[model samples]
Target chain A: MKARVIVSFKDEVLDPQGLTIKNALHSLGYKFIKDVRQGKVFDIEIDGISVEDARKYLQEIADKVLANPVIEKFHWEIIEK
Target chain B: MKARVIVSFKDEVLDPQGLTIKNALHSLGYKFIKDVRQGKVFDIEIDGISVEDARKYLQEIADKVLANPVIEKFHWEIIEK
Candidate 1:
């Protein structure tokens, strides 16, 4: 199975990096752009794991390392190939 | 219309940040994780614009600011709300 993890800043958190990108876009004449939010994607290959097992493992990963729960949120999905 | 822009490193580009995240996951016991890739998502609201027009505008944004064409790629879609 393959898994994909997407991690993103919580709604209330300030995203300076995202802001910087937004500003850069504005300067480059993309005046219609209203906001920019930055996030991460992790594509992992987990062979022989059930979807439930993969989800459980990814949740632990997110809780322990992939995200700062205080300011970030993450979700994962298992993909069968 | 709303738009979503997804930006990512080109396939040949090395993603150190993604590697760092993968290492962190390994440390946290997600031993099954094989690889990780990092990317960015931008959601923008563009009022009253046709999808074709929005796509054209976003292409310009990607070319001029959202990505380094030599190392990154980006695509966008307009959303009606």
Candidate 2:
């Protein structure tokens, strides 16, 4: 199975990296951009696992390793099975 | 409009970060994981622009700023309008 996971800071958390990107865009004259949020994406392939087991394992991976519970959250979906 | 952009290393490029993550997962006992690739995601909101213009500007941003053409590629989609 192939999966994609996205991990991002919570809305309440300040994102300096996103602000930096927005500033860069403004400097480059992309002034129409109002906001930018930056995050991490993981493309994962799992072998020899049922779809149900893959989902559960991916969920556990996202929670335990991919995201920081204090300020980050994660979402994952199976892209292929 | 709101858009999502993903930038990732080209297949020919080596991704040490992804390898590190995969190793970490392996040590943590996610033995089913076959491969992993890491990438960046940007969530952007554009104001006062037509969807057509927004898409064009976003394409430029992805090409010129978010992705390194030498070793990375990018894909983007408008999420809201």
Candidate 3:
């Protein structure tokens, strides 16, 4: 199975990188752009794992490694091969 | 209409954030984790625009604002309401 993990900063966390991109977009004449929030995506291929196991494992990964719980949040979906 | 934009660093660019997460995962006992690359996803709601027009406008936004062409790549999909 494959999985796609998305990790992003929480709403109250300051996102300087996202802000920089937003400003760059405004300068590039995309006035329609309203907001920009930057996040991370992890595409992974996990072999021989059941969907339930995958979810549990991924959650652990997210909590312990992929995201900082205080400032970030992560969610993932198992992809069908 | 809604759009989902996925922006990522090109393979050649160094992703320190991704590396840090990968290392953290290793430390956290996720030995199964092999590689981790991070990217951004933009969920946008675009009002009053045709799909083609939206694509064109988003392309300009991505090129000029959302992504750094020198180091990043961006792709977006229009979502039907």
Candidate 4:
């Protein structure tokens, strides 16, 4: 099975990279863009774990190594392939 | 409206960071893991654009500034909220 984890900065955190991108977009004539925030995704392939165990395991992976608990948040979905 | 863009490496590319994380997982006992790949995402908020125009604008943003087309692929979805 495959799993995808998305990690994003917490809502209140300052995002300098995102702000830069937003400003650049504005100069590029995308004046309608109001804000931009950036995040990460990790795609993993797991071998032969039960569906129940897979969900638990993926969440553990996400929480432990995929995201920083203090300033970042993460969630994951198992992919059927 | 909002748009989320996901950027991922092309399959043939070497992913050193992904490898390092996977090896760490191995040392921590996730031996069932076969592969890991890393990517990025951008979340943008747009003000009062029509749905059709928003989609087109987001695609251009994704193509032009959100991703490196040489080694990465990007896809985006507009959010309703």
Candidate 5:
């Protein structure tokens, strides 16, 4: 099974990286660009686990390590590969 | 219009960050995790453009700025609000 985790900064956490990207886009003549929020995507392949267990375990990992709970949030889904 | 860009390392590019996460997951007891590939997701909010143009312009930004074409590839999609 393949599991995907998406992690992003909390809304109140200012994202300098996103701001920099937005500025870069503006300079590149993509004047239509308004705002940008950047996030992380982790694509994982695993074995010896049921789909349910895969989701459960990945969720734990997401919380404990994949994301920083104080300033970031994460979501995960199982992908059929 | 809103657009999203997903940027990822090329197949030949080594992803040290992904490996770090994999190891972290292993240490966290997510022993089931096998292979991991990490990527970037940019969620953008924009105005004054049709969806088609939004996609086109974001694609250009992705190519020239959002991604390092020498070692990364990207895909973008327009999302309805």
Candidate 6:
């Protein structure tokens, strides 16, 4: 099975990297852009596990390692099974 | 419109960060994991433009700023319009 976990900052958090990218794009003349938010994506492959078990483990990994609960949140989905 | 751009290392590239994470996960006892690939996601919002224009600009941004063609590849989709 393969799953994708996306971890991104909370809505209220300040994203300096995203802001920098937005500014850079504006400087490059792509003025239509209004906002940008950046995040991390982890594509994980698992072996010898059922879909149910994979889902459980993926959630645990996202909660324990992939996301910072204080400022970030994560969502994951199984892409292949 | 809002678009999501995902940029990931090419398959042939060695991802040290992913390897480190995999080792860490193994140490933490998640033995089911077989492989992990990490990437970046950008949620971009554009205003006052047609979908066609947005797509064109998004492609340009991904090529010029979001991804390194030498070792990385990117895919983008309109998530909201």
Could you give the fnat of all candidates in order? 0.62, 0.93, 0.36, 0.94, 0.92, 0.92
Give the per-residue lDDT of model 2 (tens digit) for B8-74. Answer: 9998899999999999999999989988999999999999999998888888999999999899999
Per-residue lDDT value at B66 in model 5: 86
Give the poorly placed runs of model 4, Cα more than 4 Å off: none
lDDT at residue B58 of model 5 (Cα atoms) = 76
lDDT of 6 by residue, B1-81 (tens): 899999999999999999889989999999889999999999999999999988888898998899999999999999999
lDDT of each: 0.76, 0.94, 0.75, 0.90, 0.85, 0.94
Candidate scoring better on lDDT of 3 and 5:
5
Clashing pairs in 3: A25-B65
Q: What is the alpha-carbon RMSD of candidate 6 to the true structure? A: 0.7
* Clash number for candidate 1: 0
Q: Which digits, one per residue and each the tens of the lDDT, describe model 4 over residues B1-81? A: 888899999998899999999999999999988999999988889997898999888888888888889998988998665
For model 6 chain B, give the 10-residue run with minimal summed lDDT. B55-64
The best-first sequence of candidates by TM-score reads: 6, 2, 4, 5, 1, 3
Model 1, residue pairs in steric clash: none
List ranges where model 5 is wrong by over 4 Å. Answer: none
- Model 5 has an lDDT value of 0.85
lDDT of 6 by residue, A1-61 (tens): 8899999999999999999999999998889899999999999989998999888888899
Of 3 and 6, the candidate ranking higher by TM-score: 6
- By descending DockQ, how would the candidates be arranged? 2, 6, 4, 5, 1, 3
DockQ top scorer:
2
Cα lDDT for residue A44, model 2?
97
How far out, in Å, is residue A57 in model 2? 0.6
TM-score of each prediction = 0.81, 0.98, 0.74, 0.96, 0.93, 0.98
Query: What 10-residue stretch in candidate 1 chain A is worst by lDDT?
Result: A40-49
